[model samples]
Target: MATVIFTKNLERHLSCPSQQVSGTTVREALDNAFSDNDQLKSYVLDDQGRLRKHMLIAVDGSTISDRIHLSDSVNEQSEIYILQALSGG
Candidate 1:
């Protein structure tokens, strides 16, 4: 199982605890993690089931490239980090 960790900033909005979920890809892992928490899922993904513009995911220290499908691979020891992207002008 992969360990999913939500950022502290995101937790400020809602209670998103770290979870150990089973999956071989980022999407599957997140689906398992969000199975009981639809609100957190909504916060991370858009209506089209795509990653929201402000949401970011890092799998074992590297950002994911397939935002729409979240096809990035993961393993049992993987650490998946989910966070809101910061932007400033």
Candidate 2:
């Protein structure tokens, strides 16, 4: 099971209080996490279910390019990190 870690900014809406979760891929875990906290779905993804422009997902330290396809497979030992990108001058 892949372990998903959410940034502090995302902790508020998480149903499970832990910083990490277990799943087989970035998408599956995110789906499970969002299912538990539907309110957070809109915050993390766009109306098209794509990673919002301000959000990013990395697997085992490698950035994911297909935000629309969150079902990308991940290994049990992989570490998934979800964070919001800050934009400004």
Candidate 3:
């Protein structure tokens, strides 16, 4: 099972807890984690089911490429981090 972790900033606003879930893809792993708390899902994803503008997801410390479908692959030992990206200059 892959471990999904939400940043403290995100955790402060939403109750997204680190979870150990099983899945072959990032989307699957996220969905599995959401099974425990669906509210967390809505916070990270928009109505289009795409990652929200301020949100970033990474796998194994590398940035995830598929923001639209979240198709990034996940392994048993993978660490998935969901972060809130800072914007504005």
TM-score of model 2 (CA atoms):
0.77
Off by over 4 Å in 3: none
- C-alpha-based local distance difference test score of model 2: 0.75
| Candidates' C-alpha lDDT | 0.96, 0.75, 0.92
Quick one: how many clashes does candidate 2 have?
A: 0
Q: What tens digits encode model 2's per-residue C-alpha lDDT throughout 32-54?
A: 66776766778888888788888
Segments in model 1 whose C-alpha atoms lie over 4 Å from true places: none
Between prediction 1 and prediction 2, which has the larger lDDT? 1
TM-score of each: 0.98, 0.77, 0.95
| lDDT (10s digit) by residue, model 3, range 7-75 | 999888889879899999999998899886768889999988899999999899899999999999999
Decoy 1 TM-score against native: 0.98
lDDT of 1 at 28: 98
lDDT of 1 by residue, 9-52 (tens): 99999889999999999999999999999999999999888999
- Models sorted by lDDT, best on top: 1, 3, 2
CA displacement after TM-score superposition, residue 37 of candidate 2 (Å): 0.5
